[model samples]
Target: MKASWRARLAGPGYVILNGIRVINIITFLDIIAASVVMLVKISLTSGFFFFEAVTHAVTAGVSIFLLISELPWLCSYFDRDWPLLGHNSGFITLGIAMFMLGAGVLGNLNRKDMGQDHLGMTFWQIVLSAGVLALVMSTINFVSSFVFADGEKGVTARQIRIYGAVAGQKGEIPRTGSHRTFRLSMKREDTLPIYSPQAGRKSPTDRNSTRFPLKIEKISSPPPNDAASSRYSRDESGIAPPDLAHHPALKGEYI
Candidate 1:
C-alpha cells in the first residue's frame, strides 16, 4: 500500500494536482495581498480613518477573492466562445478598466483643498499617491497573469497530444531539428488541433497516412567470407587476412 501510494504520488497526475494546488494558494495569497494594499491606500488617503479602512478592506478582500476565483472560467469562456477577444486580450482589457476606475474614484474624492493639519497631506496629494500605487500594483498583477497564465507545470495537454502525434511510432521526443520545426509550427493557430470530438475515432491507418512515410530499406547481412565480415576477425594490429587484403575491392585498404 505504501509503495502504491508513493508511486501514485510520483505520477504525472499527482504532479499536476500539486501544481494546481500551489497555483491556487499563490493566487489566494495574491488576492489577500492586493486587498491589504488597497486597504493601506484607502487608510492613507482618508488620514488613517479606521471605519473607512475596515470597510474598504472587507470590500476589496471579497471582490478580489471572487474576481480571482472566477477569472479562469471567464478567460476560458472568452477563449472558447469569443475568438475576437482572446483570453490575453480580455485580461488586458480588464486590467486597464480596473486601473482607470480606481484612478478615477481616487481623483474624484471629496476632501479639503488645503493640506490636513494632522496628516500634513492634502486630499489631492494622497489621491495622487494612491493612484500611482494602484497603477503599479495593477500593472504588476497584469504582467504576472500574462506571463504565468499557463501555470508552472510542464507541457499542456494539447502540447502533449501534438507531441505524441508528431512522434508517432518512435514513442520518443523529436530530434532537435524536428523539435525546432515543431515549435515554429506551433505558432500557427491552425497548425494543431486544440480539441477535437473526433480524435478518439481516428484510426491508426488514418494517422499513419497523414505522417510522412519512413524509408526503411532492407539491411541484408554480409556474406560469411566477405572482407566486411573478416575485418572484425583481423589481428590486433588492424591488418586484414592475406585473402581479404588481396581482394580487388580492398587492395589498398586496411580491411
Candidate 2:
C-alpha cells in the first residue's frame, strides 16, 4: 500500500532534517560564489578592503556553525548513542546567524564603491538583493525552528531552561509513557495549626469563670414554650404524660 501524506511527511523531525540539509547546501553554494566574487574583486582592484573582509568573515562563521549543526541528525540516523544537543540551540544559532548577516550586509553597503559608478549597476543590485534574500530566509528558518520545536523530543525552550546546548553533555528526552511521581510530606510544623494556646493556660471552666470571669459567653437556652412544658410534665401518679400517650413515636408500651 502506498503511504499517505501523513506517513511520508511524518513530523517536525523529518522537516527539520530536510531543512538543515537545504541550509547546508545553500551555505556551501553561497560560500563558493562569494569566494569567487571576492577573489575577482580583489584581483581587479587594489583598493583597501575593510567591509568586504568583515562581510565574508561573518558569512563564513555563520555558514560553518549551521553546517556543524547537522551532526545530531547524522548521529541519530546512524543509530549512535550520542548526547543530543538541546533542540533550542537550533533557533538561537539561526537568530545569531540572521543578526550577523544583517550587520555584514549593512556594513558592506556603507562602502562608497558599492554604487553603480564604481561597481556596475547589475552587480551592486545583485549584492543588495542577495543580502535581503538571505536575511528573509534566515528569519523564516528561525521562526519555524521555534514553532515546530514545540514538544519535539522534549527539547523546548521552557523545558530545557537554557538558551543553548552544551557540547559533550548527555541530553535525555522524556518518554511519552513516563510517569512523574510527586511526594507530599506533612511535617509537624506543616500539619499542625499556626497558632496554639500557651502552656499552663486553663480551659474555660465554671470554677475559673466564677473567680476570674472568663471572656467566654454562656450558651443561652431556648425560649419557654407553654405547649412543650405541658406536654413533658407528668401528673401526681408519675405515669405517662397524656400528650405523649397517643404520640406515634411513643405509642409502644414503656418498660
Candidate 3:
C-alpha cells in the first residue's frame, strides 16, 4: 500500500516541479516586478510617493528583467501585425545608422554649406522627427497586443501550445524530456504518429505560425493615455502635483 501511494504521489510531484522550472526564478521576481509596477501605477494615480522616492534599484531591476523577457515578444507581435512599425532590430539599426550618418556626415557637410561646422537642422527637427516617428511606430508596434490578446483570443490562448508528434517510427521512442508512450494492439496495417518540435508554431495570428514568443506573461500596463501625463499629475489649478519637486520645470505643464 505504501509503495502504491508513493507511485501515485510521484506523478503530482513531477507536474509541480515542471511548472516551477518553466516559470523559473521569474515567478518570484515577476511577483516583485508586478508589485513594483502596480506601485508605480498607484503612485501616479494617488500623487503620493508611497516609498518617498521610487526605489530605482528594485524597480529598475524588475523592469530590466521583465523587458528582457517580454518586450521582445510585445515588439515582435507589434511589428508582425504592422509592418510599417518595424521590429526591434530594424528600429534599433535605423536609429543607430541615422545617428551616425547625420552626426558624422551631416555635421561635417553642414560645416561648409552655409558656413557652419559640426551642426545642422538635422538636429531635432528632421532627425528628431524621424526619432519621434520611430517612437510612434514602436508604440504602434506595442499597441497591437491590446486588440487581439486582451479579452479576445480565447481559443488561441487555451488550445494553442507548441506541440509535435513522435519524431520517429513506432520502433523507436523519443529520447528527450518527459517522454510518455502508449501502445495498442490493432490490425497489422496500423501506423503510429511521430512527434517532434514543430518546424514552427501553429497559431493563426502568428504571421507564420510561431509557437513561442520571446516570453509570455500576463499583459499589464496602464492603458493608453493621450494626455501625455499620468493620472497622478496636477491640474491647471496646480493643487496636487505629482512629484512636483522632482519635475519643477513642468510644475504646471503636466498639470
Best by lDDT: 2
* Cα deviation of 215, candidate 2, in Å: 52
Which structure is stronger by TM-score: 1 or 2?
2
- Residue 69 lDDT in candidate 1: 35
Cα lDDT tens digits for candidate 1, 50-79: 876675566455446434433434656655
The lDDT for every candidate, in the order shown, is 0.44, 0.48, 0.33
Indicate the residue-level lDDT of 48 in model 3.
46
Show model 1 residue runs off by greater than 4 Å. 1-70, 74-76, 80-91, 110-133, 145-255
- TM-score of candidate 2 on Cα atoms, chains taken together: 0.43
lDDT of 3 at 197: 57
**Winner of 2 and 3 under lDDT:** 2
lDDT of 2 by residue, 1-255 (tens): 222322333343454546654764464355435433443453225455665565566576655555555434454432243233334344555555655665555455566655556656766665565466566666765665555343434444322222223211235534331343122233333333332233333433323333343334443555678766766675556677566557777765643
Ranking by TM-score: 2, 1, 3
Error of 3 at 144 (Å): 38
Q: What's the CA RMSD of model 3 in angstroms? A: 38.2
Assess candidate 3 and give its lDDT: 0.33
User: Looking at model 1, which ten-residue stretch has the lowest summed lDDT?
Assistant: 158-167
What TM-score does each of the candidates earn?
0.25, 0.43, 0.18
How well does model 2 score by local distance difference test?
0.48
